[model samples]
Target chain A: MIDWIESVLHITVQMGTLYLLASLGEIYAERSGILNLGLEGMMIMGAALSFIFTLAYGHFAAIIISIAAGILMSLVLAVMAIHMRLNQVVAGLAITMLGLGLSGFLAFPDIRKNILLSLNPALPEQALMTQEAPKLPEISIPLLSNIPIIGRAFFHHNVLVYVSYIAALVMWFILFKTRIGLSLRSVGEDPATADSLGVNVFLVRYLATVISGGFAGLAGAYLFIGFHPFWQEGMTAGKGFIALALVILSTWNPLRAVLGAYLFGGIDTVQYRLQLFGLGAQSPYFLAMLPYLITIITLILISFENLRKRIGVPKSLGIPYSREQD
Target chain B: MSRKINTPFGVIRIERRAAYPRHIAVLTTLLAVLLAFLAVAIILVLIGIDFTAAFTLIVESFTKPELMLNSVKQAIPICLSALGLGIAFKMNFWNIGAEGQIYVGMIASTGVVLLHAYYGLFDEHVLLPLMFLTSFALGGLWCLLPAFLKAKMNVNEILTTLMLNYVAILLVDYLIHGPWRDPGGYGFPLSIKFPDYAKLLFLFGDTAYTGLLMAILGAAAAYLIMDHSKLGFEIKVVGQNLNVARYSGIDVSKVIMFGAFIAGGLAGIGGLSIVSGIIGRLRPRASPGYGYTAIIVAALAGLNPWLIVLASIFFGGLLTAGDVLQASMNIPKTVIQMMQAIIFLFILMGEVFKRYRIVFEGKSGGDMP
Candidate 1:
């Protein structure tokens, strides 16, 4: 029972942290009125770059470089969707296809060979048996570690998990409680109105996209060096897209984004556990599809009319705003 | 006071600016294609390849008999899908789920073939038509979901359609890996080889020419329907503006549903063609991303059914050349994808410029620089 509990906790932490990182970036972009559907493509590019660079250099430097590459690639999307006033959704889709193609081409050789370099286990002093998977270092809070459930969930996690939580909190605060957030929201709500009020709408959209790209890149890096420590073709899978949907499901709220991520992470973890318990051979495939299926159902349930009245999506989301139009 | 401007005509003179006719859209498309080619050439040069040699290699692949046949064979499915897509786009309905519909068609066709084989129904002459009908019905039904959701529930078709593609893929994956796995095959993730009676026979000797003929028929039929029919007029109206369409007493929902059904049905035929004519067995990667590629073809062709036929052939040739480039020049197959992306960007940008002119206002007297 204790072992099972430990494994569940481990899976939840890893998946939740990865998703939180990606979805938070997505939250910012969508909140700014640019539906960056290219998140999946961006994440894939990040994964491939980080994996390749980590194999060449060390993990930390690869993380930094991958983030930079992601930001650079996102600028291409911004140039077309923001500056040129092209359709945001199509531009995002094109960016995804471009990223997927480029990454597949560059990473084909590595993927075919399955040449994954394993990370060394941290803390040689620990007496527990080391598994093949590299163990992330955990920080135990002095007094909080003694508490029962909440203590294990919050206090004892890898540095990435803590960083992701802090990032989400900081993002929530900045987006809701700050003057810049107000301006960004105004731009999203009514770009022409914002522009009339002297807000640089174009600049804000571009910045939001780049920062979103940065976060997506960090998520990709976390997937490789931080989570799995391996490389595979189409490694990011559809997680990036799910993150985009989560942004909507969360109603662009960073806190809800975390909750949504954990919910999905929990579903993913339970699916694996069900497979381990031998539900059926096809159970895993069905489980793999749960999150996407839930997203579709949730999307249908969350009608645009309801969202418009209450949660209120960006008025100009996915529509390219031209200053000259008004 | 009005002033008369002199013209090339002997006596009659008029001050006039040339009107931008609808045909200018075609010219803009051509210019976009040219720009895309130039961009591809520059990228080739940056990647340390001789652009002339690479392009020549691509062009030469089209002349070989086998490669030429392959190009047509590949174009057949894409052309059919594009026909449906063109109709939908003309009606301004973005039916992006052709990929999923195609998968559904493949599954339905495979199921029919399997059932026939199990029951010894392949010995009968009616098996082929039965398989085709089943596939088309399945494909059409798959499309009905999103169409219903969009027309009724007002859900975004793009996201729903895309998500459905993943679901269809997974469903197929489960079947191929589990129940549909051929007992005779030793651990191969493929179904049994389909019987000859269940297959689509070639019109010519040992070629997928029958599929090509069907595609041509489909394109021609779509052209006739879209151009000569009242239904086509309603589609055009609905696509241009739904409120206008409603005001004109056209049932907008029915038009959308009809368009989607036809689109999904055509994609279904494409799937059936693939299983019966090419692979002859079900596999996980049954499609080579043809459904998505059809979007590019349809857009590049300006959503005209007849033009889609020509565009599909061009894209088919590109796919053939991409394979050749992969084999001989050691270029990644993704270069073709990159070219497609570049073309889409250029075409979209060209459309923007064609619609709207940008004028720079000078604050002071300065040269045109």
Candidate 2:
């Protein structure tokens, strides 16, 4: 029983760590009113770059390259949606397409020629499971790791997992306590209003977006180096989208984003755990669907009166800023 | 108000035009698309492929009859899906669930196909009608929940629609992998092969022109209805200004529900087109992101039904050429997909030109005229 419980908790933390990083990044972007749906693309590019660079250099270089890739992709979105003043949703969708395609092209440079391995049958496959990637060594906390199941799950993890937790806490603190956070929030709330009040809405938005890119990149790198240590084209899969959903579920709170990420992460891991417990063998697909199904239900419930009251969305969440527009 | 602005070369005056000429906007869009293509060409060159070979592969996709036919066949599903989704978009409804709608439509059509295989229920005439009806109805039902919520509860349809998409796709994946898996396929995740009578009739080489015609007809119908009908005008009004639409006594809720239903219903037909029309069997990973690409097609065409047909065909050709490039040049399929996305980005970026015009002038310079 202890083993089963410990395993579930360990997997949950691992999955949750990824979601937390991605959602933390998304929280920053959303708070500043930039919805870059290209997150999956950013994550994918980060994963591929991290994988390649890990082999070329090391984990540190991989993380940096992944972050750079994220920033670059976000800059593209900023140019189109921010500077060009195009439709945010359309621009985001396009960026996502570009990100997914380019990353896939780069990652699987010769996969098509090899007939034996499965093609990225998964839309956006990123699991280069065949190749070797050096995994980040786990760092067990001294006294904390000696504790119980909680210690193993929380304290014993790679550098990325601990950093992701710190990042989430830092995001929470910076967003809630800092003047910059207030400025960013105001811009997301009403850019025109913020601009009228002498805030450089453009600068704040750009910074927030780039910050988002960094976290997303770190998440991707962590996904490859810390968790899987191999790459696939679409391996980030729907995690990016799930993180987007988490942003909403958190109701724009970075702390709540952490909670939401872990919650969803637990839901994602539990299904596989069910399969391990021999319950999912008969209908693993049905069991596999638990997470997505839960997201739908949560979305519906969030739309209800009580939850809706709690959820505070940015006023100009998706609108591109234009000086001329009323 | 005319304003003087500083420039690197010289000071310039800026003024907002009341409106730009339609022809000018068209020219700007064309120019943007051309520039975007040039940029992709540069991208190709940087990726170690010669620009000429890439250009040749694209040209070959259109020049070859077989490739062109394949393009049209692939285009049918995207066009149909885009046209359907375009209606909701016209009302500013984010119906991103077209992917799920299309998947379920396929599943429903496959269900009908299986019926014919097992029970021998009715003739092809009746079965085909059943297939179309079931597919459309199921797809509509799938989206109705979100639409109803958006209208009544004032819920965000974007989240609901997108989440439903995952649910629908996972359900399809489940079916193909387990209960629906064909025993004779040697562990491949695919449903039983559809019977001949259940398949869509072909008007081309081993492919169905039925879907392509349906897509064109659907577009025409959408064009007529969106431009000419009262419902379309109401949708436009609601999309442009919801409060104003409500003040005009347009029964905004009904419009939302109806628009979503029709949109989902049309996407359902698109799903049926591929399953019954092209693939002729249910399989895992059957769709190559047709529903997602449908959004680009719809957006690129400015949500105009007729133009969506063109955009869909263009995208379809890119897909075919992508396959060809993969086979001949060893290029990844993603390169073509990236090209499609770049075009989408360009179209979106060009939107500013539709509403605003750019003027280049030196310091202290007056209008050209």
Candidate 3:
């Protein structure tokens, strides 16, 4: 029983880290008053890019490339939502559509069919179809590895997993303790006020969105290399959207983003675990529904005005700011 | 938010226009489309593709009668879904789970068909209407839960509706994989083929025309209700400004619920048409993301029902062209999604520029510099 429990906990942490990385990024973007809904799109691009890059370069370089792809995707969101002052929802949705479509199209069956005007598949495109993903390296702390259950469950994880934790801590400090953090929060809560106080609202928003996009990209790379070690089209599979909910659940707090991600991860893990219980008799589809069901229930609970206020949701979040009018 | 900024060379002032000329709006939209094609052309050239060849491939694909029929047929459910989406979008209700609503509609219609077969129930003529109504009601029921939560608890409908989409999809998946699975189909995750009685009536061309007709009817109804009815005015008022709508003594929650319910109902009809008119079976994955695509169509059409039909058909052609491109150019049809996204991004950018004209002013004499 303990062994079974330990395995689930370990898997839970892995999944939790995936969502944590994404949500932590979202927390920053939302803090800067930009609701980027393209996390899934960006993450998928990261995954697809990492898969191709990993085939060509080593794992670390692939991760970097993936992060760059993520940053690039987020820039699109920033340009639309901040610079152009377009509808964030529409722009974000378009980014997602573009990312998913671009990745999928890039890896289609060798297009060079026997015909008069057959388009040859690019080398990377061909490789995407026939490449085996190399697993990300795992690292176990020296003394911590000897701590038995807790160590095995938490201490021992991949480099990316540890990076997620470190990222969360760094993000938490930046968001809570630092001057830049304050500026970001102020920008999100009241951009007009923030702008009046000489905070470059536009710059802060752009930085926040780009940084968050970087984090989401790392999460995608982690999922592909550390967690699953494989890539599929749309493998980000609404995790981006789930991360969006996690930001609200955590009230835009980076540390809380980690906790909220784990809670969601627990729901996902337990659902999968449930399918194994009762001697493996339960339907996995029913199990799959549990996370979504819990998400709805959680959304309902948090939106009750009481919890929402307690969590300190940014007042100006998701609303475009016009400095001149204010 | 509106803003004006001073640059080094000139002061570029951005001011919102109360309204622009209709011709300019049309002209700008056309220009944007043309720009997108130009961008595509540049991409094609960079990728070593001849534009002439690609154009011929597209035109040739359209000439094929089967492809044209398929494109129109495919456009039907998407148009229906888009019309439904337009109503909710106008009301500021983000019904992201039209995908799930579509599933519920399919499930509801499929259930009726299965039950009819099991109990030796209604005749074809009698059952067809029943299927339509059942699917509509069930779809509305599915959507109502989220709207109810949104109204009562101020719940974020985007997240709730999105989450529900997965639940609805899984429910259908579970049903199809379990009890609903056709025993005679060698364990394929699919329900039995829908009976002919449960099928829709054809108005013209293929029976798929029923779906197109339904979409047209829904769009017309939405146009009338939005432009000519009190409910439409209420929804518009609520959408435009919640405070003003409340001041006008409107039940904001009630208005939200009505629009939302209808949105789901229309999407459900789209789902019903897919099963009854297109697929003819409750398969594991019935929709090819038509519900999601409908959102794009609605936005592209600027929420106009008449324009939605044209946009839907245009998208349908694009989708068909994607396939043709895949066959000829060896590119995946999924590239169309990227093209559509680029077009939408341009649309949003165009909308921003349209709403606010940019004017350059010479730098002031005593500039800080």
| Predicted model with the maximum DockQ | 3
lDDT of each: 0.77, 0.80, 0.80
Q: Which ten residues in a row have the lowest lDDT in candidate 3 chain A?
A: A111-120
iRMSD for every model: 4.9, 3.9, 3.5
Candidate 3 chain B, poorest ten consecutive residues by summed lDDT: B200-209
Candidate 1 per-residue lDDT, tens place, B74-105, comes to 88778888888888778766777778888888
Tell the DockQ for candidate 2.
0.48
Error of 2 at B103 (Å): 0.6
Tens digits of per-residue lDDT for model 3 on A41-154? Answer: 888877776766676666888799889988998998998898777878778888888888877755443421111023323344444455357878778888986676767778
Among residues 3 or more apart in sequence or in different chains, the pairs in candidate 1 whose N, CA or C atoms overlap within 3 Å are: B91-B239
lDDT, candidate 1, A153-270, per-residue tens: 6677667777898999999999999998888888788888898999998899888899888988888888877777655667787788778767877878899988888887877888
Residue B52 error, candidate 1, Å: 5.2
Candidate 2's C-alpha runs over 4 A off are A111-130, A276-278, A302-311, A323-325, B1-4, B12-17, B202-208, B365-369
Ten-residue stretch with the least lDDT total in model 1 chain B: B9-18
